[model samples]
Target chain A: MKKLDNTLIIGIGNNTRQDDGLGWCFLDALVKNGFNEEKLLYKYQLMVEDTDLIAKYKTVFFVDANKTALNEGFLIEKLTPSKKVSFSTHAVPPNQILNLCETIYHKKPTAYLIKIEGYEWDFKIELSKKASENLKNAIKAFIKEF
Target chain B: MNPRKIIIEPVTRVEGHGKVTIKLDENGKVSDAYLHIVEFRGFEKFIQGHPYWEAPVLVQRLCGICPVSHHLAAAKAIDQLVGIDPENLSPTATKLRRLLHYGQVFQSHALHFFYLASPDLLFGINAPAEKRNIVAVASENMELAKKGILMRKFGQEIIKALAGKKIHGILAVPGGVHKTFTKEERAYFLDGIKIPNIDTMIDWSKEIIDFMKNYHLENAQWIDNFAAYPSNHLSLVDKETGALELYNGRLRSVDFEGNELLNIEDIEYRYHFKEAVKPWSYLKFPYMTKYGSANGWNRVGPLARLNTCKYITTPLAEIERRIFKSTTQNKPNNMTMHTHWARLIEMLHCAELMKELLLDNELMATTDLVRKGTPRTKGIGIIEAPRGTLIHEYHTDDKGLITKCNLIVSTTHNNEAMNRGVRVVANEILSEKPEITEPMLNQIEIAIRAYDPCLSCATHALGEMPLIVQLKDYQGNLIDEKIR
Candidate 1:
């Protein structure tokens, strides 16, 4: 019933792992850019808990890392409610989270999954060289679009 | 009859990477079954050189699902390193940490029982793999799925409000915590975040319990002898009050008969509990000293905590526990499948506890948030992780640089029991004809899923977990596979 009109941008990834934190890097960029209209959230992974917040939003973007094979740099894909949600407490796909918002919360916030490419996701915090460059390109694109 | 093998690799629904392998003998009878944990995170070996205070924050990165557990356990261990007495935790700091733990437990348990475990319990273990998930639940029963998501959001909101983030919030420190609970936070919980949904938040848990109770016969059997094995149980219990303690308490071990085996000091977990590694798994097997490795292994998590505690400190959960225990005739209930119910009850306890903690007037004490003290070289912090008992031990130098660190996570504690459960289910459910139906394969996983092991989903990426059940020939070649 109440709308925040705030486009909820959730950056999801393991920040401690190299390149995996690329999504977090985007959230950092969003904050540093001083773009205040949208609510910025950082989560390690998407969960069932996120749907309520997503329900209040007018639109949502889930920024995450993709293995190189999935996307070489970054790909923004439209999301549909996924009927298949695996039995897990920690992980739910962004589409499924959107589905929960539409199904449970009675609100359908237009949703998109922004997949960033990553080379090394080892137990390190800093992004690898290729991932860093890709992040920069993705940031430039985000700035232009937003 | 040629012996056939059914392998459920990269099992979906649980955390981290683990698989189930069921072997059928020449007579087509169940010969051997094993649940294997394939990944190895050498946190113990790698966290050695970091500063002692960094242990809590560093280990939180281990699991996105239960970072709060690792965070609190590491903080408590570091608290010991800084010489905070178990009996003398700063009142304000203790209460704040308890509130934080409540949020963690609430969110985690809500997520597990409703979203993960209930998918099978409600849908049936024999249900088609493609049709047995929350999406199906949402489509068929939108109300239940809605309640589950919102309830989970409530728990997560509390976590985000206190810890500053949902996944890994660095709020705790050695002597005490980093922040205090402010009015803004209370208002956030009471009005701001949960304004319109308070009624749903409070009422839905009761309805869920009542709904689940409707299927007593079938669900009880689901949790009965097959997956629920009798073994020693371990959890944190108040030394004096004998109540179930999640945040801080003395370690207690009980037999399957609910007899107290040992009342161990938290500092003595290393001396009493021993972990042994097998060649097959990266996870270690933990067993009590008295029973020895061959038999001393015990179950933890909701079932263990529920069975071992004398009384719960909270309200609604306490009532639920009474009914639960009465079902077992007030003795130690060993049914592993009932862990789902126990988790739900604990979650309700957390909600009630949060209501009490948030409304109380005198909960904040920024003055005592951090204590100034000389650091000790070694400290062991223990807490009942939502899954089970989480022990974080760090050895440091006088300068507080970590020399060695050993972590005993929740799932590893149940490793032996999970493997044993697979065998029990295979023995009972698997036929001599090696039928290997989807339900039979599902039953094998049902045994392991009761544990809700954190081993698989620990890495926690956006990677899709397609439910795949693979049937392999004994020669290690894939015979057939079904991806749901």
Candidate 2:
């Protein structure tokens, strides 16, 4: 945020959960396409303390894979701070993390949830071919928007 | 009048999903209350047919919160496959594993205390939910929050340096580790412990303990007395000197009065323990062998460890340990809520242990990192995780592929206690009212949180849970319901 812009592109998911790794793959494709920036980071999952890290950015694009999102390609939705607060560390959503950012940091960054359709969630590391193709299209569409 | 039931599903503030069920009798007095922990667990059965050596790294996938514990425990169990004499671990290999373990415990303890449990104690459980999270923690005390983040990161740095990655590290192998502690890494941590101005991880942990014991928890303990009940405690201790032993030790069980009940070998755990499966939950209930099911259910984890140990070895943690052992200065600290204090003491001990290992001359030795030997069938490994004693038992064939495996994690060990805690809290709080309140339910969850149950090990339930909770009359008809 301090470098070129206040925007952050973060990919969040487990890399080993087949298409769940779409977040990492999407970021990797962005990097390969020469759309690299210091603001881009990848996390295994959204965490409770991530609010502090998110507060620094003025805008954020959170990329993840959703099995139930639109099957066409990808869906992008604007995010607002939600009042949800989790006592458990495992089930926190990105919007709630932003809500925490708003509550604690007193700054509300513009954020969006970028969800790519995924079919498989097996125990291996490689992405399925269909998932790979969808990732490509999703990245192509997302970059165009950016 | 029909009976009513109140249920809280996915008991928040822990590592995984759980549920608490409270049944009200016709008179509106609390009749039954128990906690059910759920998770997806088949790795033990699924790991069969894989090479014995693969168990160490494979089981690490079970819980992201405690991968290092699994990694080391599996590695140690496989060590027996090669038949390295117990006390004869190659000096170099032993030193490296111990350092890696200390790093694991330090980071994990820091994460649980600063991230998970602190909010409840720092801000009251009844505090506004938005103000009771890490964000608020960061806002209120910027330095403490920042220190927690950095110190937790420092522990992960050690893990990355040794295991290659912070989470699913593929470092520990049977008999030893793959890498040696390099001098450069040691210097980096040594500096991390003390730099910028004059600050150290040890001192930070001490300050946390002091603050918690003296002010934060001291004022709040009155509200969380459900955590202060008596129960049997279990932990691993040095067989000779009876000190708190993390990486390896004999299993010890003590009563509420701190008198030893029994000390057994890890290999003999199967004979001394029994696991029962309740029809309602995915998690199994584990109890001791001699006492039978009625009297055998006991508790493990930080509180148990502190209660079972004769003394802590590190000077800073030892000072805290004496205070923790008996808040009254003469009895075992039975308050489950005080596990937060016990965790900080352990973190302090781990930091001191990490410094001692980092400065040791033999830590950087490149040779003897692994031992070469033939594999044998049936190997057992036991180690103390950040939570409690973790047991990994494997039986293999002549071909070295696993045929059977079983794991008894700390959460499973404390399942009964968690349920009992929920019941105890409900009994203490509930009255003739037919309806239950949200704060009352949250207090029940606080009971389960006291153990920090790791449901990843217990979860084998398929698909996502609809998390439906129903209230029924004594005849079991759906009279009321809540879905979450």
Candidate 3:
């Protein structure tokens, strides 16, 4: 894997929730591909403290499972801070973290979101076959694009 | 004149999914109201087959906001299962656990005030929905928002250092904590070099309390009276001195006017408490069995803690607590909105407690982290979580597998109190009104939010809960629906 300095990759989702594990699985794939383990973070959800974390990095990539269908099994798009705000300590959206970072720390890291389509959200840990395929495509596209 | 019901589904700015239903009589007068928890997670049943040693880690899956509370509570119970009571634990181990618990409470209270409840307080309930959020709070008051973020971070950092991660991190094992605090970890919080130090946290906590006091003074009419009602209050108080105790203590309950109802050993909770289920919601109403279902229910959170404890041990918080009590002439403050004030005082108390622990050299002990004695088949652990009193009880068979598990989470205890609050607000704001407006709906939510109810633990689910309101006729036909 190519070495990327000063870049933080945050994989946000719960691995116990079947396809919701896509984000963490993506991070696992990166580690398997020889990416620096320190650069990757696995999170069940984003929180206010994440703003402090992203401030030190020059770039950040948020990867999570998307419930909605995307044309490509996966999509990677540049991200902008969300003006709309909603909060539940159980989970906070990635874009909102970026917005908080810009608001508090006055630093806007170059950010992008890699959303992999998912299915079968249940209590089980195993991803559905279709979601697994989408995760593979997402990892492949993510590595090439970055 | 047709009777109607107004439903507010998925209250905004709360932890999990809950809905409010206000039933109006044919005369357009409020007849009944309820706060319903929708999702259900059978954690108690799922935890039955797990080993006794795994209880601490397994229970954390119940909540993200207060996982540390769950983790510590389960750890205490696991400690008893291994035959070590709280008093028998090594002093170093005990202080380390206390520090971790205080850190958990500190961060959680900061999150609740700065992120969740601050919006409703900063911008009045009548303010537009878009403006009632942390982002909007940040846009308007950047320094305040930054302080909120840093204050929360300080607490998370403490968790990370003691445990391994911020959420669901492992700290305690069966008999005692798995690890000990180090000088570097202690310095990180005390030295104030990297992040704001303990002193700074204490200072900022004081500043917030002042802000709350001033806010109360300006909005006294609403702050003291909104959704206010008299009921029983419950929490853990210091076993010996009767001072405010969060980590471990004897159970205490007092009525609305400051009458002692029950004060007993924490482990003997089952003998006094009973849970009653309602068909309308997944959450159960917990009350003292003696008082019966209707009158037995008690509110168990910051407001309850202040109401039950004789005095705060910390000097600064004691001062603030006195001022808070004076508002009601030192009687139990039944004001629902004053919960935010009590929560801030607790945050300050936690800050003072953290400083005392960090400065103490006992945290440096590396040995004697675990201890055990004669084993027990059943163990109960209760602690003051940020939201309220959290109880975890487990029974294991000879094979060491859990045979039964019961959890009376903080939100569960306050279920009835929240319903009463909703009814109070609905009656005040919506009774006799022909139309249901957004502000009207928000006022009902404000009542529930005052308790800082963690519906995730109440109903136990993980998902997004968007705000939706539906109006129905008395016969249960949907007349109108609106989603935000």
Candidate 4:
């Protein structure tokens, strides 16, 4: 296992969609724990598919809630692109994003995904109890990994 | 004589989903023409129960292309509802907002001129499908195309810096923006001002102006009579005092004859304005009932803003206006075909405003992000969105939970105008040609698309929408139909 000095952690989820904000919550926790700004790259939404950034970074951590698969708590797993995830609202998907980085820059960053199980995907601000707990666990695990 | 059918499906390279239909009679004459919007996502309905503070974030999701405009309007609305004074917001915060807006103007106008509308100019309307794109234009005019790309990128970078992300920024809150512009950020912004390639942009704009002068002058007759109606025009005016108020001011209503009706405040909006839903489209039409019979289903946005304002404040835009007026009747409504021209003028104005706001020393003094006051029982925020006039009306409980919310987007104002424009084109083109073809229909669609209606913003959201198109003959028979 390689421990990187500099890391870019991105939280990808809709904050209004309850558990979709899991990625952002993890990012908030890291900031609260006195994580230095230089070691983190916290983002709420993946608006543009800037492939260059992905290729340049050493380690990339993406935190989002998995709505399709129900895991009620934090599920820490290393995610590789299986085809392209069309679940994103953007033009480029996660798989294509990785592929673009590799093909264009000949570099692949070590990537891990932290998915918290979400119960509510509807338009709401407050998170479910299970999702909130999952988020807390995910943050702990993420800190441990760092 | 056998009639040929022309199909230009998916109208590629545009921002949103839309289609064009044209029918010609046997004698190669146009029989019917229409511009049809295929997708409809109701954003208004989704926002009904959301908190007032969250309105900015929710509405920003309306359009990926111009999310900043929605964000600005929503922020303005919140400010209005809460009656937060401009002085309360740090002048720096306001300046940052203005800068972001100018950045929006730069990128959006560039997208329209370079990618969407340029094809019609660079390649003639009759250009082959493969040859009519920015990529094709880049192959020949690489430097020119690169300038547009750079300009757009610069604008996006400004937004990305001020707000955490580009598309939907959380920085813009109810009272004011959450963050302030640091010295480093200001230096980075000033560094952007040093780019020498901006000269290329000026030259490109001049070329576009020349094209508008020549080609658009000839085609102006088509848009002249289409959707010509009288209505009041409303926008944010500085009012001698430099205070910013989008929701509290009097709504300026300008007539077809360029006369001011009454500049009533937001509370009086119901007395003068009422929204009517048409069966043809999901967009709601806001009409001035005070004008006796609602004859004026007027437009909002670029063209409407230009028409409403007495004089543009910016020097560069004023110069452009002089040149624009030299070619026209000097009346704002006369140059309907010059909506593209109006967009560029507003872009200049927004830029000038941004520069002035950034230089204001008072902007750095404000520290209060949210006003320390009770939430209003009821409030309305009205601002001129990039598309046009946007209104966010809300009713909140004592606990700050939202009870009801109503958003009347800019696209809704143009709803009636679009329908009227389409009917005019359809009546003229369809009646002349007997055979219906795709190219002929596309021209009519182009007319409607010139408005750039964001129906998603207008309607709010329910679910993913499938495309739908319906054609009716003179005898009222269903001639052609497609729904997916």
Better of 2 and 3 by TM-score: 3
lDDT for position B461 in model 3: 75
Model 2 per-residue lDDT tens digits across residues B1-484: 6677777776666777777888887788788887876556688889999999899888888877788999888888898887753465678788778888888888888777777677777787677645656667767776776677666776777788888877788777777777888888788887653331113888888888888877635675563365577888888998888899998889999888777777997678888999989887778888887887767777888888888888888888898888775564756777778787788888889988988888897988888777766667877888889889888898988888999999988888888888878878888776575565566666777778767777876563322333355667777777767654
Q: Model 3, range B1-484, lDDT digits (tens) per residue?
A: 6898888877877888888888999988999999999889899999998899999998988888788999989999999999999999898888988988999999989998998889888999889888888888898888888889899999888899998999889989988888988888888888888899999999999999999999998999999899999999999999999999999999999999999999999999999999999999999899999999989999999999999999999999999999999998999999999999999999999999999999998888888989998989999999999999999999999988999999999999999999999989999988888777898888898899989888888769755757788888889999889998
* Residue-by-residue lDDT tens digits, candidate 4, B233-343: 555544453122222244665666667765666555667777776454455667877764356466777777776665676676677767766654665564344677777
lDDT against the true structure, each candidate: 0.78, 0.78, 0.91, 0.61
TM-score of chain A of 1: 0.90
- Candidate 2 lDDT over A15-128, as tens digits, reads 889999999898888877776567788888776556667777889989999888585768889998887554455446888888767766687989999898888898989888
CA displacement after TM-score superposition, residue A144 of candidate 4 (Å): 22
Question: Which is the winner by lDDT between candidate 3 and candidate 4?
Answer: 3
- Residue-wise C-alpha lDDT for candidate 1, range B1-484, written one tens digit per residue: 6677777777777767787888876687878888888886677878888888888888888887788988988888888788786555777888888888988888787777677777687788778887777777777788788778777777777777778888778788888877888877777677744443444555677777777667666555555666767888889998888788888888888888988887888889888888887877778898887779997888889989988899998777788899989988999988777777787778777777788888776576567677746557888889998889988888998777899888888898988889999988888888575356777777777787778788932322222456577766667677788765
> At residue B145, what lDDT does model 1 achieve?
80
Say which docking band candidate 3 falls in.
medium
- Chain B TM-score by candidate, in order shown: 0.95, 0.93, 0.99, 0.82
Interface RMSD of each: 2.4, 3.9, 1.5, 7.6
- Fnat for the candidates in order: 0.84, 0.25, 0.84, 0.00
- DockQ comparison, 1 vs 3, better candidate: 3
The alpha-carbon deviation from the true structure for residue B214 of candidate 3, after best TM-score superposition, in angstroms, is: 0.8
Question: How high is the lDDT of residue B64 in model 3?
Answer: 81
